[model samples]
Target: MKLILKACIILIILSNTAIAQRLYNTSEKLWKPQKDEAFLQEIATTIPTNEPVVSVAETNETCFALMSGNIYALKSGKLNKDNSAPAGVTELKNKNGDIWALTDNGIFRFQNDRWKKIDDKKYVDLCMHAGKLHAATSEEIYRLEGDRFVTTKPENGYYSSNMTMLMEDGTQLHDDPVRLGPISKIESYSGTLYVLRPGKLVLFDGLIVNEDFIDWGLLPSKNTRDMLSFGRRLFISTDRGMGVLQGAALKTIKGEEGLPVENTTCLERGFDQDIWIGTERGAVRMLKDEWHYFGADMWLPDNKVNDIAVGNNVVYIATEGGLGVINFEPFTLQKKADFFERHLEEWGHKRLGFIHTVYQKDGEWVREISDNDGGHTAPYLAAMCYKYAVTGDPEARKEAVESFNAMLFLEKVSPIDGFFARSIWSTTGDKDEMGRHGSGGLPAKWYKTADGKWYWKGDTSSDEVTAHFYSVSLFHDLVAKGKEKEMAKQHLEKIAAYIIDCGYTLHDMDGKPTRWGRWDPEYLLRPYGYVDRGVNGLEALTFMQTAYNLTNNKKFDDSYNQLIKWGYAANTIRQKNVFPPENLAPWDDNLAFESYYTLLRYEENPALRSTYLRSLERTWEVKRMEHISWFNFAYGAITGNDCDLEQSIKHLREWHLEPIEYNFRNSHRDDLFVEPGYTSYEGGLKAISPREKNITRGSRNAVALDGGQNGRRIMEPTGFIRDYWMARYHGFLEAPETNDPELTSVKRRTEQQFGAEPYKGLEKPVFY
Candidate 1:
């Protein structure tokens, strides 16, 4: 027994030393060894055009877009009219560094920066094969010989069909087949040129034309729009799905193989190992086993993708409205965090020490005075705490202190002691609508402060309180020092004591408990309260346990023990409700995790810890598929387990640079696997990428398959900033060994704070 005690002492010393060195603000001890790696960051720059683009091609670092029967060249990232080109151009192609345009009257070659008509015969399609330019008229296949397209007659007659036309809006207009003896499209791969007829494909090998290479009867569909040479195989787009032809063996990639859309319109080879497919609805990138969707106003000018052109690390997507250019740049996670940090200031998301989302009004970005500003700012404060703990930056420390003070001010401004307001607003603020009632239809409980400077909103729910305790706990442990630490302890004591005084309820000025703030047995023990009993029990226990841990107060300890004996500990086992559709809410998981972090970290009783751990495991298992970085990091920090780090990082990396709430509808996708609404009303088997979904602030359901509105409102990027810094502090994610010197937040800070000269390369882009 003595030896065992000595060993325990040694373990305690080692643990304390590790904690002191890492300076984590949590009670739990866990850390991942820092790994050095860089992730590519995607940034989109939309180039708007008046006319719809029909086709696009890139060669020799230059891109050309054919729009409205005219050709335009993209020079220095902007499109310019190629005046020297001939009119009536229908399609453009690049063959051996030569730009060729197929016009309505003839074929033209760009020579000495001037388009010269090479052949006077109209051709339906053209391609480059075996180091020669090939064109197919209605009856004959021709090859280029000394700038002239000469006939490459075959033993068999050429297959032909009426050419498909595009509407002015760049959408394909499929007409009833007339079989007018015109080849619609032509493609070449592996020394063989494939010709598309009305319902069949014919192969031409410079001498012979036959239909033996591809058995059209075995393909997904007979009506093919486009074909692409992908590695060793030819991918043909059809209405049913994508057909793959490899050495006469035909296969299909449909919904069963994770094709998001069924009606494939066109196909293009991607910059990487991926392949780009265009549907009538949107563009799809098949990167190995994953499918990354690009649609909606956030990603494209229009969902109708006409053509796609790849350049270096960028992709130019021609749509009905304009060109959407997606540029891929090297970025570390640190650089992304820096980008969001700068975003908050440049977009005016901060007001009075609180971070806010923005909505457009009269062409200006206006800060929204949301009902849950206090609750919304909690994560920002928590982020600062983690940032200070990890970097020891004074700016982060100052920000944490100011935000904590603002949170405590919510309680101070209220008429009743220990009763915090949902939000505080100035009487003479902007004319935006202020909510006069809570979600439960309670009367608006607005009261003037003693100084008459603010009107504090009342009838606060447990959400605000939960945020307060969670962030304050972190602030005290991770950021607060000396006098500020003492202040945090007292602030927590007052709130916890107030709850006890009111019999586990937060009351308004009317001396009645707020509708959702009740945690006492009188409320939670009833059948109507069954849904909230688990989460509320968890919250109350956490408050008492955290208060006692910080202050060593016997009163808090006694109350905590009494609550545990009252079966509240057992009640927490079901804290994460997964049944009864109406009871499913995304924010409930947020509150439960906030309580779980502090309660499990500070709770010392081994038996109770086991129970809480069980609850945490159950809840996390339900949430693991979301790939939410906060939930994953919190679980990893507490349990020292592999908590989906790679998926979490992927989630973080997929965030769009712009946080606009654009409409995203994925319910019609063929590859979507809808699960039972166990966790959310619209839960799915997999969480969609943040880039393809509505902009979220961590509380929204990640599994919600479809949601959004007009792109007028923008969300604060704090959800991303907080999760990233928390991961850094907990060592779940490490700082990259190399970072883009211009994109770092430190560069912005040095220029703004230290009066440093701005380097032209480091100048930041204005987001708004």
Candidate 2:
């Protein structure tokens, strides 16, 4: 016992130490140019090396390239690698028609037929901000005055230091105290200057530094990998994922949600507000509301994307492998509207209703389908299809019918004896292994018990019989629609009888009867009400209602009342947030479980209707507006909250647009660019904090924008309009009020923050 205790203590200490080290250690090695000026004359005589290009600029129809410590000018589309200028250029920018290049030696102006060096004593990072060329160094910030560089302070206040460390490893690399820390890169957006340090991001508004200008912690990542300003948001690549700075808050885009890569290398905004990300792994493009990946398999020659630039409607990428280019026509609002219309026409009208059919075999009842993948059940698809069919579009109706038929095929089960078997292959008589039978067969039936009970099956635990009951309820709803009504009724009767036979009420076979079920025998039942079991109870009640409505049977009402009592007791357990380990079912402990299932059961219980509505609101308040695939009990929660069954679905909508954190590490810089596969930013946001308001506007900066009218207008302006609307459709936010003053303020702030001014010369482009 003493040795075991010592080992546990040592493990805890090691874990804590590891966490602390990870939090504080953000250092990285700085890249040093090999043999200063070696590429200057060498490139002038020999072929250009494969060292990736850093910066590219075009002025007076001449294209100049900055690569591997040397500068080259392209004449007649041919790079002058042989006789290029002998300057180690660091930064390049074009103002009006003239090109300015900042190099290690000094600043130079390219015009007419000369490379005129702008002699200056001090040098640092350079950028064109508010139509002026500004240079920022460790000691001070300087702007061009007449033909010379002059010192200038920001509008608020200015702080200059002789000694500072700015680079990832400046403390060990540079020896000059006068050199203003390590300024890796500099960029100007709207009228503000942004500085990127090792692990920090700061903004200078021509005055004092706004310490709160951007807080990455709100959208935390492992490291500040890379950054880019596009449209109305600032995109930042971090060790874990990518972050977008909208207003004062940073919203993260994780790699787990379909990002091509996580280790972002560079970012650029294109002609149509299209944002391009170049990462260590590949390249990704965000246009309007869609994301596309380009790599070795998709036009890109390599995966190591270093930098990106836009020229003549084409995007250029520099990678370790080679240079690649992609030419894509910009998406338009008309196309977006048409697409949305088509989407709605095909799948908009289906009203999700309560399930009516439940199948019982031997002594256990079962559902018809599972909720493991994307929560697409046959009944759900049918309801969605039916809703879309009501739009008076024949094609939509046809598609809806086809989808409904497909669901029928997916949920069909063979009947046997007075009761039906759980599935075609599995018999309900094998209860011990089958555990809780649902209308749908087990995703994997290999683990079935001899008594017909499904054991700890694939991925999910065995104790979660509520999912099965919910499935039964969903199946029953399909029956009422005149599609297999007889089968649905028969299955419902069998399930009711099975429930009664199982100790007169629903209870886990392995444990004592409580308000909820358990996941497995070894696992203790959670004292918190089981969401899965509540869903089952709700399904039973819905079945009873259907029976009563069909036959006017008092027994159905009695059974429903009993189930409602059970539901109320279970809800009491959940409100306390205390669950005895012994009572926990596989799906019972999740906090969002009960409310999500309750949303579906609202149609059955009119007596306790208000209680269910309140529970939905409370769940929304607690979950915020995030979507967790595991917490799918609320698949229809949004519909319930939106319609008469509940009061407000605002929380559902809020969570749909909330951003979330996926990856949180810096093991490899390449991971910064990897795209998160098929995940929603809003879904992630809700998963983090539930109490966060969906809509908030303050000053010129806001983190999460409510989908108000202003938000919709700016959505297009910022290239996120499609996502904003989709979020609404997915019950992530309330329908936006485009005319609200709060939304107008958001638009103004977005413009001011991004420094986007309407340009007559540029073609009108679609917003995201």
Q: How much is the lDDT of residue 693 in candidate 2?
A: 21
Question: Cα lDDT for residue 743, model 2?
Answer: 26
- Model 1 residue 386 distance off true place after TM-score fit, in angstroms: 1.3
TM-score of 2: 0.43
TM-score of 1: 0.88
Candidate 1 pairs with clashing backbones: 161-182
lDDT by residue for model 2 (234-330), tens: 7777756687777777777765554646667667766566788877666777678545555442234456766666665666666665456554432
What are the models' TM-scores? 0.88, 0.43
After superposition, the stretches of candidate 1 with alpha carbons farther than 4 Å from their true spots are 1-36, 48-50, 74-80, 155-182, 214-217, 428-433, 441-443, 674-685, 743-768
Expressed as tens digits, the lDDT of each residue in 1-768 for candidate 1 is 999977876675454345434432444544444453665677777677888888888776778899988999987768898887888898777656677788878998876667799989998777777777778887677888997877876334333222234345743333442232357777787778787776566676654445566544366887888888766888888889988878777788987688888788878778889898988777888998688888867777877888888878888888888888888877777788888888777666766677777877676666776778788899999998888777666788898988888787777777566888888776554434466777477667778877766777887888888898999998998878788898888888888998998998987788888888888988888888878999999999999999999999999999999898889999898788777778888898899999988887688678998899899988888887677888988888778777878778888888888777878877777876532333532345557788778768758577776777687887888888899888877777767776558444334443242111111221111211
lDDT of 1: 0.77
